[model samples]
Target: MSLLDHLSEHHLLVKYTTKNEMEEETRDEGNIRKEDQCNTVKGLKKNWQKWANNHSEYQKHNPFSNNRTVTVQFQKGEEGYGRPREGSRTQQRGHSAHAHLEKEVDELCMIIKSIGEAGGDGQTRVAFGPLFERYVPISNKLVGVLLRARKHGRISFEGEMLWQRRDDDVIITLLE
Candidate 1:
């Protein structure tokens, strides 16, 4: 049934003791809906922090002159936005950055297998030249992804480091 119908049926039936109380209940329900509808939107400020121990300039950086998306913050005592209401599905589906990173690693593997040459040993291998040319267009963080893939034993290379021009001939083989 529709929302209004469900609320009218259930909301009224659940506590139908007297006619006067029913009128009060209806008014309270309307007020609750009005409060829910009148929401406030605010732009988020960028928060920046530097790693004091890290020496790399990359680690010591902050947000640049980019206009990021506005975010929502649910304040405490405001019912904490009363969200994901106890055992709700949204509450159960937690977020994980590693899960997405792992998916990127898997995509990297797919790109290698698709573009790379196949060996008689039934392994797919691609040179750094081809892989870089192909993968860089998909994601600029190709080196980081490659390193992650290697760490997961998904792909193997010969060197400790794979630089752009220097390691162009480095063969990245997908391990079974």
Candidate 2:
């Protein structure tokens, strides 16, 4: 967590607690002077503004224009091609998993469109069996991508969640 996030929530607990609890908590956490926090925040803002004001020419210093392959996962302390050193928080899980998300989604869409059965409402629907069998080889992150696509209203499935082999017959419909 950043200093900003820590400062916001840490100070709120003492305000809500009883006198005894507050005193105990304060003793445990140690006393933090508000002035020090304010000065630190101000210093950060001033430094950031100074850096932001100096806009170098794009032709001279364009980081993204570099041509090199960058792998997804690397052990801590190793840097990749053209990657920023900005203290990235997300490490193992979440956003790091979806490298070729667009291609995966396109392949999934094409697979469902090809093998899906027609529903009574005239929508193309495929069983989880076909999707799993076909897509797992293409991209092992099929389930995660499916959840992402569903979150964005691209597809709809009938159940709380889909399971391998168990929910093979569960129908999943591609939303047009």
Candidate 3:
């Protein structure tokens, strides 16, 4: 057989001794350090409550600003116009793929810039006040997942074959 099987086959004495000896071995290194540092299953609930309290305070102190102007722009990288015009199926797959690439690029650029400013360590978390602290981690993780996905699989529209071909090319134009 194999090394493990051979050992078990012959070494009956060791197996019997080993099983009983290790059975009572204390594996629960509970909180190894202290309440603040050691995060475990039991600690998760405890820490979450603490974090919840801090977050509540943060929200109370810093109200969200409604005065900031949101300007939507259109181009490859910026938020507004890069997206394909709505309801147009022309090169939909290609457009979507490019859009995904552009989005990933933008996200990576932002993360890298942040990381650089944060000294390339996981130490300083940026705070655009409390609003950013709440969303940055989740947003970073989402972008990371998307970027990783783009590396392997191709994005394409699969289902729904709509619009039969006309005798000549049928061109439709949309106005914004």
Prediction-by-prediction clash tally = 0, 0, 1
- Which candidate's lDDT is highest? 1
Residue lDDT tens for model 3, 131-160: 133335656453243334334442211222
Q: Report the lDDT tens digits of candidate 2 across residue range 72-104.
A: 444566775445434443333334555557567
- lDDT of residue 58 for candidate 2: 28
Task: Return the lDDT, model 1, position 146.
Answer: 91
Which order, best to worst by lDDT?
A: 1, 2, 3
Off by over 4 Å in 1: 1-95
What TM-score does model 1 achieve against the real structure? 0.49
Sort all candidates by TM-score, best to worst.
Answer: 1, 2, 3
Prediction RMSDs, each to the true structure: 16.5, 15.7, 23.2
lDDT of 3 at 175: 10
Each model's TM-score, in the order given? Answer: 0.49, 0.44, 0.20
- Mind sharing the TM-score for model 3? 0.20
For candidate 3, list the clashing residue pairs, or say none: 74-81
Model 2 regions lying over 4 Å from their true place: 1-99
Query: Tens digits of per-residue lDDT for model 1 on 1-176?
Result: 88867986886788788899988866877866544544421111111223323323422231242435343446777863756545534556643556778889999999988998899999999999888998888899899999998998999999888999899999999996
